[model samples]
Every structure is written in C-alpha cells, then in structure tokens.
Target: MMTGLHLVIARNNYVKKLMGLSIFQVSVIMLYVSMGKVHGGTAPVYVMGENGEPDLGVVYSSPVPHVLMLTAIVVGVATMALGLAIVVRIKETYGTIEDDEVIEKDRQEEEALADR
Candidate 1:
C-alpha cells in the first residue's frame, strides 16, 4: 500500500517534481558512498612518515568510487537547483503547479485559438 502511494506521488505532474527525484538521487549517492568506505582503511589524504617518505605499507581503500560519488553529488546538487528554478518559473506563469491543470489550460487555449 505504501509503495503504491509513493508511485502515485512520484507520478504527479506538479512543479518541483525534481524535489522528489532529488530524494532518490541523494539516496543512491549515499549508497555509493557507503560502498566506497572500507572497514579498516584510512582517508585518502597524503601523509609523510617519520622517514620523510610516503607510507605505502598500509592498505588503502579504492579511491575510484569515492571520487566518482563526489562528482555525482556535485552534479546532483546542480541539477536539483536547475529543477527548482524551472518549477519557480512554471508556478509564476501558470499560477499552479499541478500538471493536469496546466494541460487543461493549454487545451483550452488551443481551442480558443482554433475558434479564432
């Protein structure tokens, strides 16, 4: 039942639909971040040993996933920001965020145009 409700909510055509998508995107990013972390590994920061040499003995976790997720997070934030901006514009123009209403409004406009 809960899953069905979420599907309905996600399918709605309101402006700011990006807000819902952003939640899923963030969750995926978190999953990637969790997958990137190692149980016994240290951070990727560079450190010099007492001998003034880079320590290579310690087991370092893979950096690829961490780096990739970081990039994805940045892109996701930018994408969300853009979606919000578009939604704001949509509300300002249509005075409503609902998709059904917007489509109806357009249909009426088209009919009025056809009548002319």
Candidate 2:
C-alpha cells in the first residue's frame, strides 16, 4: 500500500520516483523474508542419532529464501545508486528534476530542430 502510494504521490519528480522505487524494493524484500519463516522449524542442519540415523522428527526450514533476499538487498542498493546517479545527470542536463519540465525542454528542442 505504501509502495503504491509513494509511486503515485510524486509523478513528476525524478528523485521522488527513485525513492518510491527503493521503497517498493524494500517491501518486496520484506515479503520474501516473511515467507521464509516457519513455525516450530529449525535450521537445515541434520543431527545423527546414536545409531547413525538422521533425525526424522526434525522440521528444517529452507534457507534459500533468506539467502536470495540478501542478494536482492545488495542488488537493490546498487540499482538505487545507479538510478540516483542517472537522476543527477538528468537534473544537470535539463536544469530541473521534474519529469514534465524535462519533456517540455525536449519538445522545445525538437521544435527548434524542425524549424532549422
């Protein structure tokens, strides 16, 4: 809900869009982590009994989701950094971070080119 709200609240600002994207990424990470949890479940470590038989009564929760979410966190950070860098470049080029303003500038440039 918050993710959708952030995305919709600031449509014209590039920096706000990046922040919304970062929030959405975090929400997804949280969802994955939450789904990985199991009630009354232990780690995926197997113990051997006296007869060298693996314990059959133990319920092991998979660590795959948690590990994948960790990787996702790193990737999300990198993506956010790259996005912010792009926004900075856009601000420099357009003299504003507003999406509408940038589009207007591009349209004016195209009109000038058409007249030439």
How accurate locally, in lDDT, is each candidate? 0.71, 0.81
lDDT of 1 at 95: 81
TM-score of each: 0.69, 0.79
Query: What's the residue-level lDDT of 50 in candidate 2?
Result: 75
What TM-score quantifies how close candidate 1 is to the native fold? Answer: 0.69
| Steric clash pairs (candidate 1) | none
Going through the candidates in the order shown, the clash numbers are: 0, 0
lDDT of 2 by residue, 9-97 (tens): 75789888877887787888888888886655556576665788765566555699989999999998899899889988998898999
Task: Give the alpha carbon lDDT tens digit for every residue of 83-103 in model 1.
Answer: 778877878888877888878
In terms of lDDT, which candidate is strongest?
Answer: 2
